[model samples]
Target: MKEMTGLVNTKNKNKLPGDGVVGKTCNNVCNNKTFIYTRKSALTLLKTAGILLLVLVLLAAFTACVSRSNQEVGDTGTGTGTESSSGTGRETGGDQGDVQGAGSKDAGEFPLTVTDANGVEVKIEKKPQKIVSLTLSTDEMLLSLVDKGRIAAVSYLSVDPGQSNVAEEVKDLQKTGLEVESLIAMQPDLIIVADWSDQNAIKQLRDAKITVYALKTPSSINQVKDAVMTVAQLVGEKGKGQEIIQWMDGKLKAVEEKVKTLEDNQKLRVLSYNNFFCTHGIGTTFDDITKHAGVINLAAEQGMVMWQEISKEKIVELNPDAIFLPAWSYEGFDAEEFAGSLKNDKSLAGINAIKNNRVFCLPEAHLGTTSQNIVLGVEDMARAVYPGLFE
Candidate 1:
């Protein structure tokens, strides 16, 4: 495990006037008012009345000044005042200043209550300044919805080029495993984890009174969009989350338009396979990708459910029109080499994908993505299946 570092340092420069100060000032004004009202004799009473009026005017003016000063201090402290249309706020510190400002806008009322993927309602008292993401999907979404400085840490997979879309963006951020102690040390205001994260770890964090939001594992494009919106809402960036969804919709719309031109006969039967003979099936994001790309998924058609392993004979029998392999290597298993082996296997020569040379190595970052970047997977499959359509 990498040592936890890069935690954001937030320093509030301006302090609001304390209640004691205001209380003392009010006490002085009231004491003078009482003294003036107690004056005896007609002339003294008239003079005291005039002084009383002046004192009241000064007190009101002083109270208004204090109120305005307190408001300014609050606005400066939260970095939410005078937000620009670009969604940025006053710089707070180094690179984090811009990021802090970006996330401060469009934040709906605090003391927010929402249910998590686990069906547990969690309440947030204020906008979270320090956030930690335990899932790669949430890691990707957070980078887009908030400032990088606001993120205390992300998952270890987020820095892996083969498995993450925002690997480069999160290189400088701290990485964490499921260690409860490390998360506690970060002092995060909120922690985002996948529904599949270890229940024991989550329990421990919750026991420590940390705010942990468990997001459902997105198995389809629509589910992915929902996760994005949920994360944005959790972090007070719903507008940015909507913008990301729109961007995804816009790209998907273009792909759908192009795919509409393909006739039923022209649509290719595609299969995504890994070295372990594991392939995605119905109810998986890959299945959703195939549907949107206008391609027939061989695994779904063969009555497969989630990720399942099949024998080599099944691949031969399915005889997909195009086979999508991952463009990544892990645990000594190389996808490019697997693709080569598939092409050279004489026993599999009868397969259409092999004979037609339609075997492709799609980026695992996109193919396995559960974020807005899943549209890239859709476009990759669509373009690979019908090269001429994209051209």
Candidate 2:
């Protein structure tokens, strides 16, 4: 091969005019013998032809490679790769089928089987025309990712403007409970229930052959983002899931950049207070929100976990740098009066937060959320804790 390649290179050089290679070779051949000149010329022609053939082969191979790449990109539409589903030669697009996210994928066209948070595989033969959401989190997620007309019902809590972020949007939808009877009557094409939902209800729904997927409560921001993607995947709206994730990512990045000036020691100690006189602690979504907002959760530090109730004395002892109260607590009452009462409360009067008037009423929907909208909660808290940074 090496010898042949060298010969091809020599012939190529001889073909170029003014190289003197061909002239020198022809002179040597003519001086030796006239008969040998014809033979040398024939050999030179064969070498030149071989080089041309190799060049054509290389060009053809390159062209073929480029064409294949273009064809793949064109066929897939999304440059991401496709995977073949089991037994079906039909191509099921993976991350490439939809916008990229934690939960976006084309699980194949119809009779799609999706594995839920519980690792249970649920199959859907067609696009769900009617869907029922059993939790406020699912209500908001479904509303954001799916058409309103397809929603057969939402959790009763979703109708209360104070409890749901999409309360206004869900008001027209049927308000229902997770009772087996109600769910059976709705005849939902798909039912979304929480991991904490009643096992009996889930059993009844499954017994009826209704497609029900249980969504796990997201304890962290990443899990929350994944939840959004999961719901989007179940509803066959992976693109919407990606959009939700992107929106959350943008807000999170903005909050992160805005808080760069604040040192770790500068983070404000914060606590979330609810109507039940409890505070959010470790393993709760509120803790995730405070951490993302560049604040330390006081309750979590005090060894509280998962909505633990604290006495008034503990409130003074912890004396968070800032107190976040749900805005819905002001319902049927004056906001100014509510804020003033907390400010003047004898027990909390000595607290630094109350003394400095740093108590803020966070939106009910934003504070209690465990979905993509939790980004809104993080943003609200960040702005409240560090107003100067936002400005």
* Cα lDDT, all candidates: 0.69, 0.66
lDDT per residue for candidate 1 within 1-391, as digits (tens), equals 0110111112311111111111111111212100011111122222334577797986687677667666655554243343221122223221111122222335343545555667666767777889999888888788777777788999998877777777667778899877899999988999988887889999999899999888878888877877776677678766766677776787689889998988898889988787778988998999999999999999999899999997779999998888877676767775656777777888789999888877777666676788777877787777767778866
Model number with the top TM-score: 1
Clashes of 2: 0
- How does each model score on TM-score? 0.72, 0.69
Model 1 residue 210 lDDT score? 95
